[model samples]
Target: MMKMWRVGLDEAGRGPCLGPLVVGLCAVPINDVALLVEAGVKDSKDLSIKKRRELVDWYKQQMDSREWKYVVNICSPQRIDAALSKDGLNILEVDLFAECLNSLSQQLSENVSILADACDVNPQRFTDRIIARIRNWPWQQSEMDSIHKADSIDPVVGMSSIFAKVTRDEMIEEISQQVGFSVGSGYPSDPNTQKILGRLVTSPLPHSELRWSWATIKNKWMEKYETPPPIRNESINVQKTLF
Candidate 1:
């Protein structure tokens, strides 16, 4: 009997003011989807850190047995800034999603049904764009489905989300150790991140991982360097797209 596969892709750190954006892909046999469900797999956000770590360890074991396949694409802060300056976040995500999918497709020989947590407002459009980007796509009877909040609804996508979240979290921890200070979650809303953001234009860290194009960084640069700041009535376009 031939095998059929389900490929799920998701991302983490898209909205952070610091750190890299990570996209993850997980491919499992269609008949084995229930195995993941029975093993308590769900959205990463709903699982505690310890739970996520436990599940990741289990996933590694499964991979060792060739029961599944996975991969991740890390988009550095510099790469993200360049994307924003060129195409934009949506295009960047499309590329990253395709990159991850292609990595897994190279190893698998069966038809795949791709499920992605949509990053674009129009889920169908997102689905179409991804299909168009893939190389030698539609292998056998392959197909793709992109839906909003797929992580919460589809166990496969949820697994992918967990992989992405855990990878990004580890990277953030490494960055903290390197800087000798905790940067928090690297989101602007994070108090620790906000407190450290003021130093971007002043005592800039030797680490070049900071997203220089973010509005948070731009505002800090202007606040520290601009003289006689414009009045509130003046028009200012410091805000950058957050994807």
Candidate 2:
């Protein structure tokens, strides 16, 4: 019997003000979906950090023996800023998401289906945008589904989310060690993250590893030192002065 693959796509750290944006793809045999669910896989957000880590480790163990494959794209703060400079955030995400799917397609020879958690308001439109990116590929005919909260509904996407979240958390920890303190999940709402940003701004412009393009950072700079607009002087009445 021929084998079939199901690919799940998801991202982590999109809303965070710090850390890399990670897009993860997980491809497994169609028959094993039930097995993964039986192993306690669910949405990464619903799982504790320890459980997510454990699941990721278990997935890794299955890669070689079970023919399961996965890929991750880590868009660092610098790369994200560069893309955001040229294209808006939505377009950048579409490009990144498409890249991940296309990359995953290369790893499989069997028929595959893809499901991604939608990042845009319109799920169908978001799926169209991604398809447009890979229209020329051989796998363009592959089934694609983009839906809101797919991670929670689809166990495959849920597994992908877990992979992305775990990978991003590890990356943030490594960065924290380099900076000598906890960065607090790299989200703007995190008080520790904000505290670190406050300290970095006082030092200089273009702080290394920070996304200066983010409104959070820009607003902080503007609030502290943005100069007032120069007042314009009314043109003098030269004729009246001469009279």
Candidate 3:
């Protein structure tokens, strides 16, 4: 029988107003799927930070022996802004997913199957879009599958999610150290993230780390500097003097 590879794709930081968006992919021999499950792999969200970190380290060790292959694509705030400006988030995500899939597909010489967590409301449409993007890629012959929440059901995708979450968390931590403050998960709901944005948005030109195009930043700017209605020129007495 021909060897088969199962490739999984996932992303992190998609909802955050801050930090880079990371797309992660992992490929393993089809026969080893059960082994990954036995190793305690699950959706990253279902695991604690400590556990995720541990799994990431373990995955690295396995990669050294060619037991599995993985790739991560970091889309910085600037790149994300540019892409969002040109195309919406869905398209941007598809582009990154396609890129990661293409990279992972190159590592295998046999038949392969690609799976990903669908970001769009319609799983089929999301799958179609990803397929379209990778149609010209070398992996055109590969099988594709996408679902609403593949991360929770597919151990391979869960592994990719773990990789993505850990990578983005580390990036955020490094950014926090550079700024000498906690950014708090880089989510709009996080008070620390709001605090940082509140300070940075006041600058005439906010730092590059900020996604200025984001509604969170834009709304804050408006709240701080929205122009009040122009006061009527009562002092000029335009009705009394035509001079």
Q: What is the C-alpha lDDT profile of model 3 across 1-243, one tens digit per residue?
A: 667888888999998888888888888888888877988999999999999999888877887565688888888877777776677788878888887865655556347888899988888888888878774544535688889789999999999999889989998999888878888898888988988876666545556666766878778777777832111111110010000
Stretches off by above 4 angstroms in model 2 are 135-141, 227-243
TM-score of each: 0.89, 0.87, 0.87
Worst 10 residues of 3 by lDDT: 234-243
Order candidates by lDDT, high to low: 1, 3, 2
Give the C-alpha miss distance for residue 63 in model 3, angstroms: 1.8
- On residues 1-243, what C-alpha lDDT tens digit does candidate 2 reach at each position? 557788888889888777788888888888999978998999999999999998988988988888888878777777677766677667767877887776765666347788999999998988899888974554633688899999999888999899889988998999889888888888888888988876655434645556666878776666666832122122211100000
What are the per-model numbers of colliding residue pairs? 0, 0, 0
Please report, in order, the local distance difference test score of every candidate based on alpha carbons.
0.80, 0.77, 0.78
Candidate 1 on 1-243: residue-level lDDT in tens?
Answer: 678888898999999878889888888889888988998999999999999889888887887565688887888887777777778899889988987876676687457888999999999988888888887877677889999989988888999899899988998999888878888998989999889866544543313667777877767767886733222221211111111
Candidate 1 wrong stretches, greater than 4 Å: 203-207, 227-243
User: What is candidate 3's local distance difference test score?
Assistant: 0.78
Candidate number that wins on TM-score, 1 or 2: 1
For model 1, give the 10-residue run with minimal summed lDDT: 234-243
